[model samples]
Target chain A: MAPDQIVFWVFAPVSVGSAVAMLFQRNAIHAALFLIVNFFTLAVFYLVLGAPFLFAVQIIVYAGAIMVLFLFVIMLLGVDREESLVERLRGQRPLAIVLGLGLAAEIFVTARASLGLARGPANFDETVNVGGNAQALSHVLFRDYFLPFEVTSILLIVAAIAAMVLAQRRERTTVEAAGEAEV
Target chain B: MKTPISYFVVLSAVLFAIGSVGVLVRKNALVIFMSVELQLNAVNLALVAFSRLHGNLNGQVLAFFSMVVAAAEVVVGLAIIVNVYRRMHTANVDDASLLRW
Candidate 1:
């Protein structure tokens, strides 16, 4: 196996394992931490796939900005762990069993279909004409996809305003009494 | 020889499936949110793999878009969660059965 294969094998498990852990973690903070690890491993996977731009964005944007937002909300809200641990499915065992069984059957069928199919070869050649560097990305974003790019910016702006509106409403209700007294 | 592209694709599918299960089975809102992020990452992996296979930059570009969207989603989603928590005093999505089955 090549060194790249080794890296892929190692990091892929790390990503998937942490994601599973995040799913089962009762504590919101612990789940967030696992998600951070999962995002970092995914960044490594992007690096392995030769998308350096994606690797950087994965680390900076997803792991850095987004996860921090999640952590901030977790801290601000102070989620009560014990209260969240109460399972609501006291009598839903049969339903869960049926779902699980159906999922297993689907996986079995998928695996059977995929068996004996010739795996596509990996393209390790880096000298390809498709430039994935930042410069190429800028050109595409500004040229062919310019309209969509601008639309995305507007979408983001709208999202920010929506968030602020939502937060401000809560602040208004919570601080109403204090505001009335100060006025 | 290096790991085949199929391995990465299969790995991504597994992660995506696990994330889907988490989204479906888990009651904790935060876990469900993280699972959604996990599914997004799985798509990124698939995008990168396809980029490698086709010798094009489109998949990487889409992955970048996915990352940006994921960031925006987290921002909006967390804000919503905070709002929900304030009004309901709980994020137990299962008990959010006011809509009813």
Candidate 2:
């Protein structure tokens, strides 16, 4: 088998296993650690997909910044809050399982339904080779996707302000959750 | 040599399913949050895969933007979780069901 196939086979199981392990982990910190493993695996996938820029961003942002934040919050909350996996709601576990399978089927069909998608990996290699992957992506990012890029800055600033407000305000009112403008 | 795009599509589907299941089954608020992040990462992986298949960078750009959104999301989300814990003294979603104190 090709080295590409080998890498894919290796990381794919590892990623899936770690994510599955995370679900079973009652401890938040352990789950966070499993997620870190999954993130690193996805970063490897980014590199394998020829997204060198995204690979770096994945590590710096997802693995570094985001995971750190998750860990900090988990630790602050304390680890003893391990959840009891019992299904209080009748058939909740079976229901969740069925829903998960249905979601996977839907995603599979929808993703594959698109036409013009390739069978094997694409060959933007020449483009990527032009002064390397970073240079090529910079062109697409700055020129083609300029407007959305600029708008993201606004979204980020707004999110920051919302977080600050929510954290500072002392209240149990669930209305404060409106500030939860998450995603 | 390149791996098949189908591999990534399948992997992403499976990962997303796992993430959703995690969200549904886990009672801990933080674990649910992590499950959400896992879902996002699964989509990101698929986006990168599509970017490779199309021989274009558009998908990657979208993925990048999603990452930005995710970062912002985590910040606000964590704050909300912390606040919920402060008031209810527990981060379990079922326990914090009431909209108000």
> What TM-score fits each model?
0.83, 0.89
lDDT of each: 0.75, 0.86
Q: lDDT tens digits, residues A63-173, model 1?
A: 898888888887887874733445566745346545645664565456446632333344434344245467666776677777777777887998898899878664356
The TM-score between candidate 2 and the true structure equals 0.89
Q: Which sections of candidate 1 miss by over 4 Å?
A: A83-125, A129-132, A170-183
> Which docking band does candidate 1 fall into?
medium
Q: How many residue pairs clash in each candidate?
A: 0, 0
lDDT of model number 1: 0.75
DockQ: which candidate is best?
A: 2
Q: Write the per-residue lDDT of candidate 2 for residues A1-183, one digit (tens) a residue.
A: 888789999999999999999988877888889999999999999888888889999999999999999999877877576676566689998899899999988877876676324554345677543678888778889999899999999999999999999888575577667667553
DockQ score for model 2, please? 0.66
Give all candidate RMSDs, comma-separated: 4.2, 6.1
